[model samples]
Target: MGVRSLPAEAYYGIQTLRALENFPISGLRPLAAYVDACVLIKKAAAMVNGDLGCIPADLSQAIVQAADEILNGALRDQFVVDVYQAGAGTSHHMNVNEVLANRALELLGDQKGNYQRLNPNDHVNYGQSTNDVIPTAIRIGGLLALERTLFPALADAIATLDRNAEGFQAVVRSGRTHLQDAVPVRLGDTFRAWAQILSEHLIRIETASGDLTLLGLGGSAAGTGLNTHPHYRQRVVARLAEFIDQPLRPAPHLMAAMQSMAPFVAVSGALRNLAQDCVKISHDLRLLDSGPKTGLKEIQLPPVQPGSSIMPGKYNPVMAEMTSMVCFQVMGYDSAIALAAQAGQLELNVMMPLIAYNLIHSIELLGNTLAALNHRCLQGIQADRERCLAYAEGSLALVTALNPHIGYLNAAAIAKESLETGKSLRQLVLERGLMSAEDLAQVLDLDTMSQLPGDT
Candidate 1:
């Protein structure tokens, strides 16, 4: 590795180059949000250090300018380390440092890789270590993702579902539990339930994210605050809060914060919980939109693509299918994040690179998938009123309402006779003298039975 040279135009230096060789695993680069988080940290550190006179004003200005340039969408490709590189994300952290240092060197009217002018570790990464910076980056990355992607996406999806629920409120359909008809339910209530589920998930995600605001940025190599200015922790956190417009604060216990990855695990767990519900909702959509000719096509999902390669004129629940796949992937990432979170040793968790990638990726993937599903499928769903009414009227479980008018045993006998004789429940009940036609009609009213509690 001695005397090796990088390309003259390359902003990343020898360390990133060595990482390129050492860990040729997964060709993936650090995520955009992850890079922005690291750069924001670098920018804040430069500002604080310059203010405190820990680094020269001109040098700090150069570093700040370099970070700003990256923030403003420059040198996006300079972070070249593989995502699966060095433990604790040291490789990627150095990648950020080297890229900013070389760019800062260029800003100072010097050539790249001229560390004699300004070193990546000594200047750009002053008072910061991979242990602290990577953790802080994970936190910042998570917050950024939540604010910019997941929260807004969830809000829009929930609003859409609420609207759909209100629209379908009058359409009564058969409710199924354990794949068997249970009772009557308004189709709108089905959507309203989904909306409520998403709303609760949003709350849980926000709760879990509260822990992300507590950062260990000043911990340096081991949460000891070694080599940091006396006021560096508070100043840096304040600077970062202003930079991201978040209420980021120093961890009350920097050692515990740096040593544990519980915050990330919590957020990922919330995401997994949301994914579980999403899978159920997606499956429900598929079942309701199952077939136009044979299956229970109570509702139709807007087809985004042709369902099959060979089946002509066929439509599939592709968006809902895609959502289920993404949610399953999120659940998988949550498990990985949980394991990675618990894998830390006495001082640090070296599985941070994996945690960072999986957690951030899961957030973005889920947000995007849900957004797409809402727009392409959920919002476009159309209920077949006739089909829903037919199912509601035909279900043998509708006899549940007859239990109060006739005895439970008598009602069960009527339902069993109707199923066996191909006669309607109303027909069997009237023939058996279970109740008068007028009382039976009122009892079996779909609208009355499906009305939500408190509904007029």
Candidate 2:
């Protein structure tokens, strides 16, 4: 078919089609959450125009009503474009603008795609630029993804680990450092540490979200608000706050909004921190589930897939491995975002498109991966209690706890003798007269070791 151009269709040009066809790696179309965010921005802009008397109240009301419909799932089919394309999201902004304008026109008894009756550019995108609107939408979409998906999934993972902690609190296990036996710890303590790392990252994510709340709505082209009316900035941002029910604040300096992408860089850093934590946790989980016979076999991860095509009774820690791979990908995306942020130039950062694409992609991936890690790995995780206790019993490193009572020299001697003789540390302690049976029992109690003296 030959190209068909509607009067107000900004993305119907050949360039857009070619770009869309070229970059098909992700194949992921724009998300509904993102489209809803775009609608929210348009609604806010319309409301601002009405407040400034730049547009008629009825037109503003109509535009907002149309946007609300879209927000509530009215024109979802229209946003069938990938997020990673050329033109700095101009195509996306115009697509949304045209959809909202056409919907508003239809509400007013006008035909769809009739830009002359209700021009998308002139009216719908009255005081905005793809430059400003796209980045703002990226932030809004990111925040929404965090709230609706990432945070909750992470919380579930934390809760799962917390429950595991409780379940394995009494099972003593040998902790390792540099892949070597280091000390005695409860399996519960190990899981609790995992939960703590996730909890800390959750705080970091919330802090990163703070940077996202500073939107560039009023900052039109070049972030000067030059083409926009003087009062437009505050009005639009305020209306956006109402529409999204988020505490969005205007960028204190419009020039900074246009020139600097520090907020995105900060968000990327937070995501990198999260990815690092995931990598660490996944790596540990894989090691803990290393082998059923030959390896440490400290814990048994729920087997979702077979380990081999030919080997029988082989279960793989596929979830852990996949989670680690996703984390590595996220770290790479974070690097891309950082490099893009560094590449920002003078009055306008032309790299906003890449930044938006990577940040949104990272957020979504992190969210989905975390959900899978929680459901497939953490929630279904089972500790090999007998195996863990056996390892603990066999480890001479448990002598570290005895050091306080028996003195470091004697503790080392006991540990060395136990290792040389291949005897249990508890039996060695008693045989060496390091402590009586009652004292050894008190010291060897995992609960006693985990708590302070008065607490126990």
Q: Rate the local accuracy (lDDT) of all candidates.
A: 0.93, 0.80
TM-score of each: 0.99, 0.89
lDDT of 2 by residue, 258-372 (tens): 6677888888889899999899999899999898889888888988888899999998989888988988988998888888777767777767767777777788888899899
How many clashes in each structure?
A: 0, 0
lDDT of 1 at 435: 90
Q: List the residue pairs that clash in candidate 1.
A: none
Q: Compose the digit string of candidate 1's lDDT tens values, residues 1-456.
A: 487778877888888889998999888989999999999999999999999998888889999999999999999988888889889998899888999999998889998888988999989999999999999999999999988889999999999999999899999999998999879999999999999999999999999999999999999999999999999999999999998898899999999999999999999999999999999999999999999898889999997889889999999999988999999999999999999998999989999999999999999998998889988988899999999998888999999999988889998988888889999999988888979989988999989999978998
Off by over 4 Å in 2: 1-28, 80-82, 404-410, 426-447, 450-455
Model 1 clashes, total count? 0
Among these predictions, the greatest lDDT belongs to 1
lDDT of 2 at 430: 82
